[model samples]
Target: MKKFTSIKLAIAAACLAASSAQADTILGLYAGAQYWQVEPEGQFGSSDDQQAAFNYDDDAQGSFYVALEHPVPLIPNIKIRQTQLEVAGSQNMSFNFNGTAFDGKVSTEADLSNTDLTLYYEVLDNGLASLDFGVTVKSLDGEIMVMDDDGTSEMQELTGYVPMGYLAAQVGLPLTGLSLYGDVSVLSIGDHSLTDYQAGIAYAFVDNIAVDISAQLGYRSFKLELDDLDGIHSDLEFSGAYAGLEVHF
Candidate 1:
């Protein structure tokens, strides 16, 4: 079993390397990575009517994406992007969370960590501009543990998947190595609403026939509001600045 698995992995790696070693052309590949310094705010509760004031120190988030483009007509190019979200803080409550009642004087730490996976396609690509559209599935797979100074504790598990609309666009600046780009993934369905957006500028540093490398700086914001889904209800917002690197293969 181990030998078979290793053989499969080696084959996959060889194929990826062979494709990436070629020069950029009608069929090209690319990958990107970025990190953000996020500031989070707002409150969360077990029920919609019960919320606690929430605050946290600055947190860091990381994102990555890889894409494949081919000359096939009517078939969209595919890209996959993933991002990590994590935060921890202590706040006094306005009501109850995880069945622990508080009169606005109890101090407890809360951790809400999540990840978003986006699978999108290139709707339009050209020399002047490009656009992509698809769907993103946000996996809210984390937990919140609350405890007072007396060691009294409670745990509320947060786990769910939300499908959202994804769209992105990029515009090149004439007579320069700079470009502007923006991305959004949002939706309002049933009792939940989620929105994530980012806008940034990119500067190509090394562009040649074989490879291209670029630097990027941007700002991003995300909001998640839930209403009694999986016994969790809250409004959370994260906004911050980011820096990134992009490579064409």
Candidate 2:
């Protein structure tokens, strides 16, 4: 089994190298990585009316994405992004999580890592401006745990899929190697809603025939409000500034 997995990885690496070599001719490949310094705020609970506040410290998170675009007639481009969202803190108040009640001081940990898969069509792509319209499906596999002073604990697992609308736009400044870009994904269904947005400026420090590299500085905000999805209910927000690098070929 190990040898078979190694062979599959080798084949995949070879195909990726070949694709990178010819990406400029028939494919537009983009890859980016970012470091975000975010602060978490809000409350979480198993039921909407019964909740516990989160007192978390600020943390730095990492994210990365890869996208492939082609000129095929009605097919949309695809992009995949992975993000890390985990926080730990202590809560001093008494609360009930699920059916277990906790008193006095307790340690809390929550992990809400997610992945976004987007399929978008370029509505316009000129030298000066670009726009894309798409749909995104975000999957979350997360959990929250709280431990009391007596070593007793309760954990609630959260897993769900959310469908959202995606929109991205970019505009370039003539005679300058700078551009402004932003994207947003939003969904609202009944008592639940999610909104994630980012706006940034990019400087194309290295532009060539083979590849273009850019440095980015931006701010991002994510708001999640849940109403009993996967036996969890919460309202959380993560917002902060980020720095990143992007490469296109």
Candidate 3:
């Protein structure tokens, strides 16, 4: 009788262990598509004799994310994890300018894109709500063009790469078959600065199928140094609306 009782107790303990493991954490795969519209608010240089004009058109952007998370053993109330996220986007712009009475117009275009790999940890995770904080290292690439609008100038293009750091926060809430999420991030690149803010909602029809829609706003400012000319400082700001999809596994 004692042996049988011991066997039953062992079975109960095993079931409890499995239940605890299932409750402890989760891992997920995610992907999405985003649309971005960038507008330039300021000029690169200031010279009454050198007048400049810019024209920008919007573009579509997309990205993917994979995440793994578990509740801390020592502090079960808090969740800790690591996440890998990557995003890329591009912009096309035209510039026109004239200096030294050499009446000229320049057609210029640039591509601004970056990829971010980050580690994120969450402080709160209930079935309905959660909060996350993290940092990311970003790789940036940019291009610029200069031309004569009067068809009498040569075309010049400049390209370079830079590294930047970002701090981000996100909050999520679930409602019915849909989940609402919002995120904000601040970035520092050399002497330049960028701020990004976004908020949106998502719907999950099943465990692995979902769609997300959001709106994003961004602002950037930096100083420009040109050869054989006085150093110029400028500020650029842009705001836009975006709609995207999200898939989870």
RMSD in order of candidates? 10.6, 11.0, 8.6
TM-scores, each model vs. reference: 0.82, 0.89, 0.57
Q: What is the TM-score ranking, best to worst?
A: 2, 1, 3
lDDT of 1 by residue, 163-240 (tens): 889999999998799999999999898878889899999999997657899999999998888887778787988899
Candidate 2 residues 1-249, lDDT tens each?
Answer: 999999999999889777765665478999999999989999888898887886888999998999999878789999999999998888788888878988899778989888999999998987689999999999999898989899989988888889999999999998799999999999999999999899999999998767899999999988999999888888999899999999998
Model 1 lDDT, full chain set: 0.79
Against the correct fold, how does model 2 do in TM-score? 0.89
Which candidate has the top score in TM-score? 2
List model 3 lDDT by residue over 187-238, tens digit each.
Answer: 5545455554566655555541132233323322222333312222234444
User: Which candidate number would show the highest lDDT if scored against the true structure?
Assistant: 2
Return the lDDT, model 1, position 148: 61
What is the clash count of model 1? 0
- Candidate number with the higher lDDT (2 or 3): 2
